[model samples]
Target: MSGKIRACYACQRNGRLTCRRTRLGEPCLKTYPLECVDLLKRSRVAFQAGRTLKEGFRLAQLEAVVQMLEEHECGFVDALGRDLHKSTTLDECLMVSEPLGVVFIMGNWCSPVQTCLVPLVGAIAAGNCAIISPSEYTAHTAELLHRLIPFYLDNECFHVILAGANDLPEVVELRFDHVFFTGNRKEGSRIARAAACTLTPVTLILGGKNPCYVDQHCDIAITAQRIAWARFHNAGQSLAAPDYILCHTDIQAQLVQALKCYLIEFYGSDPRESRSYGRMVNLEIFNRTRDMLWRSGKVAVGGQVIEAEKYIAPTILTEVVESDPIMQQDVFGPVVPVLTVNNMDEAIVFINKQEKPLCVYAFSKNNEVISRLMSETSSGSFCSNDSVLQSLMVALPFGGVGASGMGSYHGRYSFDTFSHRKSCLLRGTRFECVTYLRYPPYEDRNLSLMSWACTLSQRSQGWCQIL
Candidate 1:
């Protein structure tokens, strides 16, 4: 029964299905614990039928996805709010034979909508059937996708399933051409292990403690404002949020004061009453974040927590050291710890001592400081004078390094991710005389000729390389 189908959790009890009619007046049955085996078989059949291979059909499907998003924009916005209490917000070469058949996409609570659909777009663009599983934590968004995707895309080629933690192992056992996952390290490891059993390719867009360095040479006020927004946006349930701050000891107090002033300016004197801020996803996340806030250094700014609302105020911590509990993991919350470094060198050393982060941020007007940070340190991505905005540009590839994650997808990178470029060499028998050098009758002259023909040089119009 195992096949290419993705599954996510809405908690076992929350798995409810409702019947609805499609735009064409066709009855769409939403079933719990979907007939995964049947669904995978049908999707495989559709792929083998070659319906998705045509450029016209692929383009049509892509357009339908856009139309669906445009028509259901309000529904998605409301669903996002319910899920996280927050707000808004490729190409190939050679033969480009076809897609990697069926792709299983499993997303997490962080940016549930984007994580699920962005990969799906790539899969569809590359002509692959997909099974999407939105994060179980964002049940409302999951349910919304479950209702909307089938209505717009080809039902036989696309399916959305809502499954719980208990179903994860069984669903992942299904053989798929590719598997894409986004979440924390623990679950990522589990997914990787399972995919390895079948030798299936996997793309992991995981999270880590992204670091931000506040240089004394830069405008503390501007730096403070930018960091505050990136760190606290969407109530800080962001994977790209600045997880911690490493600033020069000379301007530590000044930086802290500037951050406090801007926090007030942005969210008001009391953020709890502010409409701009958001809350944690659930009780478990709230407790973990709240505990980090208390166990870490003394709060320099906002540190209020309301369990009922799952709200953790936009907070900054002072007197923090590297050994603190909050520094150990990605503080996927509104709270950020500020650790002081004697100089840029100290900050660089401190940063290098830890696991490579998803992003390494530096705020400095001096180009040398920015250059030094860019060259000396390594992360999934690097940005100067800003935070998470580095990943926003479609032109750039976004992913992580080391424990952060591997593989990147954005714009054309996404298209390439789901595509299997089938190499085609349409050789003709007319060239048999020239190709005879590669035959079994090897000689020094033939070897020399082959090497000369294959070697690339700087004089060549293409990329220069040594053969």
Candidate 2:
């Protein structure tokens, strides 16, 4: 292994050093240190090649890849759980099914199953190579992915680099044709800047403060049950899950009571003992959630904490103001803040005041309420009379708008993201007479004759009505 590592370094140095390193000597790897020029060249080649291939071919290839990954469901779920400490089989399929190009940037919060599988599926379908850089925080998942990816996919085409945060700039300098990043807004901004140097295309899926609305007419029992399920999923590590709730004043207490009952039913009185409930990703996230709980306005229900296990019970707070810290940031944890408003219109206004969220959930049976929310507010997607189920629909496009995210991908959208459309125009050989009249050289008499002929044709066809 040591000899192979040395040879790999030699390869990076353009073979300046000759070693007695054989194929058995640690499997010397070659690194392609791509630059802006390389990126432009590759993009041009990909665009031309892609134009020739039919979209149907791309879609079929991606579907086959997703099916293969799904077959190894246990391997994927285990890798994610080991890396992120809390992930499910469902999360693995949801994250990995949408693939991108060969190389992509992913966050620590995401499991290796998602970080590697998602872009792997996309890149292979697009017929592009990838350089994957997993998050530093999730070292175990990163290592597992670095080890397992070569076994599942072509090793030469897919490369995984585990590096420190400071090394990201050097890595980004490689000039990928497309940069697909999933992380916080601050880091996503840095990635955007780095990709901007080469004018490379980027798809950023960043953080969100998604709001859940509970209307007065909503069934309190069903609304609370759904909210509890969404808020506690993966300890609320999801970007599209409801971060806060906006309820009509008339139903606030009823909703709160129902929420309390559901929490007990789902996680029990002692949530730390519940196997279904998950913990925060790490100590830092636990501390952040703890601080938000302390500084919040009022605790409505489920404020229990288990610091050792990084567990914060499915918490709900009331009287949360716009200025509060919990309300201001993307509360990516098991805490749900409830704010009361007079009516549905006021709820829409409140949501519009903030940056667009990745998802929005409205618990209302009225068709008018659903229509208004869908048409008036801008979001990545929305779930009517429920929460988080929109993400389960593989057929629908999933992503955020404005500050939340830049592009979307899911199922067919994944194929579209990786493929470029080429326009073609076919001219007929039989239309020779009409084509001859369009030639440049012409005398005044000829021009007048052509104009008169066109006028007659137009009059005969009733062109005025057509115009």
lDDT of 2 by residue, 298-322 (tens): 9888787878888888888998898
TM-score of 2: 0.71
Worst 10 residues of 1 by lDDT: 85-94
> Where does model 1 exceed 4 Å of error?
1-97, 441-467
Which lDDT tens digits does candidate 1 get at residues 1-467?
33332222322123222223333456443333456545554776788787786778999999999799789989966875565353211011136457899999987897999999988988999899999998889999999999999999999999999987456656777889999888887788888888888888988888888889988899988999999999999999888888999998899999989999988999999998899989899898899999988999999898889899998999999998777889987788999999988899998998899998888999999999998898789999999999888788889888888898988888888889898877644333554544567777889988875554344223223232221
In model 2, what are the clashing residue pairs, if there are any? 99-122, 100-122, 100-123, 102-129, 102-130, 103-130, 103-131
Off by over 4 Å in 2: 1-102, 105-112, 164-166, 426-467
